[model samples]
Structures are given as C-alpha cells and as structure tokens.
Target: MALGVVGASVCLLVFLAILSLDIMGFLSWKNQFPVDGKTVLLTGGSQGMGRGLGKLLAQKGANVIIVARDVKKLQAAVEYISAAAKSQTQRFHYIAADVTSEAENIRLLEEATTWNNGQTPEIVWANAGAAKPGLFLETPLETMRRQMDINYWAAVYLAHTTLKNWLYPSDASAHSTTIQAPRHFIITSSSVAWCNIAGYGTYGPAKAALRSISDSLRSELNLYNGARRSTATTTKPAPYDVKIHAVYPGSILSPGLELENQSKHPVTHELEASDPHQTEDEVAAAAIKGLERGDYMIATNWLGQLMRVSGMQGSPRDSLLWDTVGQCITSIAWLFIGPDMEGKVWNWGKKNGMPAAPKS
Candidate 1:
C-alpha cells in the first residue's frame, strides 16, 4: 500500500511538471498578441499603469493614442509615448475626454476612428478606473455611484461602442478587406475583484462586474470567430476576430496608491501587507507577457493569480490543467486564509470598539 501511494505521488508530480512547462510558454512560443503597426487606443493613459503600458506598446511598434480627462496630462503623455516609439514613423496622439459618460464614450470612439484614418483601432484598452475605499456604510453613496460609473460603466460603454464599430462598420470597404490579425479589447480590473476583503466594499464590486463583462465577451466573441472560420473560402467572411482580455493587478505603487492610502483603513492595511506591491512598469510588463501568451485572464503577480483561481467561480479558465491545479491549491489555502482574515477583523473590532465617525 505504501508503494502504491508513492507511485501515485510520483505520477502527480510528473503531470504537474509537464503542465507547468506548457503554461510557461515552453511548449508553444507563438506571440498571440502582436501589436506591431497596429493602432491601440488606451483609456486612462495620463498616469499610472495606463501610461506605463502606452510606452511599452509604443516601444513594440504600435501607433498609440492615449485618452484621459486631463488635457495637460494627456499632452505630456503623448510626448512620453512618442519618445518610446519603435521608429520615427510611428504615430502617437492623446485625447482629453471623460469616459464615465455614455455619450462621451460614443464621441470618443468616433474621434479615434477618424484619427486612425477611418479605421477603428485594432486594440482598445479600458483602463480608466478609480477606487474609493471605506467601510460600506461610511463611504458616501455618491462615492459608491462614482466608483461604479468610472470602474464599471466606463468599460461597458467603451466596449459597447467599439464593438459596434468593429463588428458592424459603416464603411463597406472596411469589411471587404481580408485582415488576418485579430483585434484585442482589454479591460483593467483589480485583484480585489476576486478576493473582496473588508474596507473595499465600494471598490471591489465594480471591478468584479468588469471581470464578469470580460468573461462574457470572451466567450461571445467565439461566435464571430467560428463564423469567420466557416466563411473563410467565401468572398465575404466575418470582419475580424475579436479577443477579450482582463488584467488583474495587485497593489500598485503609483499616484493612485498614494491617494488610496490617504483614506485606507488601518485594518485593511494590515490585511494587505503581505501582498506584493508592484510598480506601474512591472505590472504593465507582466500584463503584456500574458497577452502575448493569449491568456484571457491576466494576473500581474503571484498573489493576484492565486486570488484569481480562488474565486474563479465558473468563469473560463486560461489553462484548464494549470488553473485546476491552482484552484485546488488555493481552495485549500483559503480554508485557513479566509478564516484568519475574518479573525483579524473580528479581533480588531473587539479591541477598538467602533471607528471614529466621518466628519461632516
């Protein structure tokens, strides 16, 4: 019996090793997301991860257009992105607009389409978001509404507008051409989307909603992809294949983090202390690597990946075998981690009575 158990353990180890190698791109090295010469429109590009990713895309030969609400910041970002261009001919632009409004998002897409020489951007990234962390009751209702508007509605509106243009172009010539490269739509969500802890009630749900939308779109795009394959020999095939991806990054050390810390609860700080803090560039690089690997759900760090598998809850898995292993490991770990977090919060409340009320 002991020998039988030992043999089973060795088989499991060998299987896991092979799966690990496959997941790490050692088995397949194709760059699924090649941005060279493609036009990319990224929202929230004025600062933080948005800015970092714009530079990386520019360096990779993409014509980048960054959208943000700040004209001054957008101008600076345009310059920053231009400096990183792979060649002198690569174009860079910046658009100043508030993406929270649905009407504004429609106009934003129109302007981007015009700027791209009547072609919709091949890659659109919904990276604009804000976080307002506080106890659910203490956080103002206005802040909650604003968080949903920026973090959730903005991505929804932008994706809606862009998909309409990509799938149903008004110009007849646009669809007549045979474009082999698939288009990409990326959404920026947070690790909190998967692991909603105390003190982030206002912020977590918005990101979680974004994750749901991304998953739905990822699956829905398959319909168009299948149609394209079926009509490949015909004169009029599907316009172009669409790929949806979501990025989940842990605590990033950026200007946004500074603002988030100003109102962050002490207990929240203590709880998240073990999570690795990443830089904007580090997060951007990791996200790009995941995109290249054709991963639908991209986690910027180790902790975020664990959080992703922990609460995946029937969403599509990026790697079936690898994610299943991760899910099992995280499920066991959460047995202790979840209770420990609750106990910490419980002990803090017991020690400190009630938190001081927010000032009027």
Candidate 2:
C-alpha cells in the first residue's frame, strides 16, 4: 500500500506538470491580441529591434510611444515612425529617463500613462535592456551591476511601476464580452527559458529573471479571469483590459549588427543569412503579429527549446536554475520589436549568438 501510494503521488505530480505545460502552450499559441486603436509604449524603441517594432505598431494603427535614453535617436525614430504609423491617429512618442533607475521607472510610468491623451498606452513593451559579454573572471563588478541594472532591474521596475500605475487600473475598467481588451503586457524573453548550451552566466541570469517574472505574473493574473474568479469584482470593466504575454524566440540579427559585425562568412555576409538571424524589422513584424494573436511564449528564436528537451540539470536549485535559464535563454534569440512589450525579453542576436562571454 505504501509503494502504491508513492507511485500514485508521483503520477499525480507528473500529470499536474503536464497539465500546466499544456495550458501554457495553449496560451502561447493565442495570437488574437487586439490593437485596433490603442496607445502603445515601447522601451528601447529608439533603435535596433525596438525601432522596428515601433514602425510596425504604427502601421497597425497603434499610436507608438518610443522610449530610450538616446535623445537624438528617439527624435529621429519619432519622425520615421510618425510617417509609418498608417493610423489616422498618427504615432506618438516619449523619451525615457533611463529605464534602469528606480526614479526613472517611476517617472516613465507617470509620463507614459499620460501619453496619447490620458489613454495610458494600453499596450506596454518593456524591451529596454543592455548586455556586456566577457569571461566570468574578467567581467568587472561594474559590468555585472550594469547588466543587472539595464537588463534585469530596469525592466523589472518599469513593469512593476507601470502595472501598478496603468495596467491594474485598466484591468479594472475592461468590460465583459470584450474578447480582446485594450491592454496587453508583452515581455521579450529569450529561448533560454528552456535550455542552456554555452556562454550563459551573465546574460543568462538576466533573461531567466524575465521568465520567472512571466511565469509568476501570468499565474496570478490568469486567476482573475472568469475561469477562476467566479465572484470577482475587478472584471466589471474598470478602465483597462489586459493580457500579459512573454515571447521567447530565436535569433534575429538586428540592424545594430550591420556595423557591429566583423565577420567573413557569407552566412554572415548575405542579407538572406538564415544563420538563425533576423533584422530588427523582421523581429518587430513578428512581435506585432504575436501580440495580435495574444501569444505568451512567441518563440521568436528557439535554441533554448533544444536545451530544455535535452534533459540537463545543474545539481543545486540556484545553480540549476541559472544554468537551465541561461541555456534556455542563450538557446533562443529573441528580438522583440513592439511598442508595448511589457516584461518581455528579446533573445535574438548576431555572430556567435549564445552570449558566450565570461562573467568575470
């Protein structure tokens, strides 16, 4: 009887895990996100994939709000996206105060909420992040701190603040029967959520933080829907409607690489290089499509999935978590180019893409 009970318990646990994965998979496949006339916010939208996403969102009729510390780039992007915004509303924009600082995060939330009238950008793309590749032994503490600040903390603070200031209120205001609401939270995550192949410690940890946030946030917010909240009062259409999505994708050689690259191979030379690479425009186009469909895990670059299926573990939970997360992240090359990708991590990159640099 004892043996039988243990077996049954194991079976139940496995079944539950499978069920969760299945549900998550379904959500990942949902590509019906509505963006007809919503205000869209994109961090790091001044250049690279973020810029591409702004153009796409503008073309989709969304008023795009681009955020980045580079004022010159931001202004240039605004001019270009405004022309591209095909929307009758015309694309809009905002200069970010520096997404990595707590004060900046707070300021960004307040300012972003007021963009496009008081509409408070229904969609938020928290794609502002930075990375520095180096060996673990050589990487300076400053480098790690900067990585955490830019890639990890900045996005975290941006999401936390914006969600509290704008999203929650919007969720409160969304009406019933509104299949696709005005608000969406899309985070550009990497394929690293599933596997770890090589050079993953530094960038890997930051990317993993995003995945954990996505899993935790999704689980919590999903509960408020009709499926779990029978007596819920927050769903009576308070002011904003929402869906939080996290996109994990493969590599997209963003426009940043055209100059950043110092390669010799044709696979590295041709514009059509299929070396798991994509342009910022391509990344943005895909991201908008994913958002439209309401996909949670948009697998833009899938190297991480390979790692996840390989069945690798790191021995200790923390070690294992980072290892798995890094492998999973570096595995994917996410290039999220969207006006409002909140909490998303874009993993797409160029050259030797695995973020193989040491974490010194």
lDDT (Cα, 0-100) at 319 in candidate 2 = 29
**Tens digit per residue, CA lDDT, model 2, 1-360:** 999999999999999977875564432455466565778888888887788888887877877778888788899999888888675556587675788888887777677766666545777888876545434444567767787787778778877876665434553333334454546777876665454222334555787788778767766665544332355463343333446776655555664454324322232233223336667887777667655654555555434334333323421121234446765654353333121122222223443465555543
lDDT of each: 0.90, 0.62
User: Can you give the lDDT of residue 17 in candidate 2?
Assistant: 77
Question: Weakest 10 consecutive residues, lDDT, candidate 2?
Answer: 337-346
Question: For this target, which candidate reaches the highest TM-score against the unseen true structure?
Answer: 1
Q: CA shift at 345, candidate 2, in angstroms?
A: 26
Candidate 1 weakest lDDT stretch, 10 residues = 230-239
Clashes of 1: 0
| Residue-level lDDT for 40 in candidate 1 | 96
For candidate 2, the TM-score is 0.68
Candidate 1 differs from the real structure by a C-alpha RMSD in angstroms, to one decimal, of: 5.2
lDDT winner: 1
- For model 1, residues 1-360, the per-residue Cα lDDT tens digits are 999999999999999988887865545669989999999999999999999999999999999999999999999888988998999989998888899999989998899989999989999999999787888878888899999999999999999999878776787766766675888999999999998988999999999999989989988888777776674545454467888999999898888999988888888988998889988899999999999988889999999999998888888777877789999999999899999999999998999899887655
| TM-score per candidate, chains pooled | 0.90, 0.68
